[model samples]
Target: KPNSELKLQIFIDTSSLEIFINDGEAVFTERFYFDNAPQVWLTAKAQCLTQVYRLDGQAITFE
Candidate 1:
């Protein structure tokens, strides 16, 4: 489908990347390691709206 709306979800962590397209209609995953922090960029031919969300996690120590 061309020139149609699509829902994309991308989850990125320290060592992994996950992408879900169209509410799980398609998916992609990869593992990567970098010596320094990575940069992200977005580009599109047509105008669109974008949203970003940040998630936090709690840590536990083992006895």
Candidate 2:
């Protein structure tokens, strides 16, 4: 299937990263140590859609 659409989701947390493809059908997770803000880079051909979101308001606090 050459024309199949690809879906992805990227998540970055305190010390780790997770990437989900096809709406969680597949995922790639990594762990690293960083003390500063995170950054992103994108490169694709054939015009792909991109979305960005913040986890500030969507995160839950357990007290």
Candidate 3:
């Protein structure tokens, strides 16, 4: 689908990173060891929508 939409989800924890694309149609996971909060960057070839979320305990906020 050329004009179809995509859903992306990301989760970051103590030593892990998880990414889900298109409702879990594709997934990427990695283990990271960081002394502090890690920096993440996402890029796309064409115009796309992006959102960032911060989760604390059970609350999620847009940042």
Predicted model with the maximum lDDT: 2
What are the runs in model 3 whose C-alpha is more than 4 Å off?
Answer: 1-5, 58-63
lDDT for each of the candidates?
0.83, 0.86, 0.85
lDDT by residue (tens digit), candidate 2, 1-63 = 467888889999878999999998999999977789889898876689898998773668899
Q: Which is superior by TM-score, 2 or 3?
A: 2
Question: How many collisions per candidate?
Answer: 0, 0, 0
For candidate 2, give the lDDT of residue 16: 94
How displaced is residue 54 in candidate 3, in Å? 0.7
* Model 3 agreement with the true structure over 3-62: per-residue lDDT tens digits: 677788998988899999998999999998789987778787678887888776765789
- lDDT of candidate 2 vs native? 0.86
Model 1: residues >4 Å from true position, as ranges?
A: none
Q: What is the lDDT of residue 48 in candidate 1?
A: 77
Instruction: For model 3, state the Cα shift of residue 11 in Å.
Output: 0.9
Per-residue CA lDDT of model 1 for 1-63, tens digit only, reads: 889987888888778888899999999999977668666677887887889877776889999
Better-scoring candidate (TM-score), 1 or 3 = 1
lDDT of 3 at 60: 79
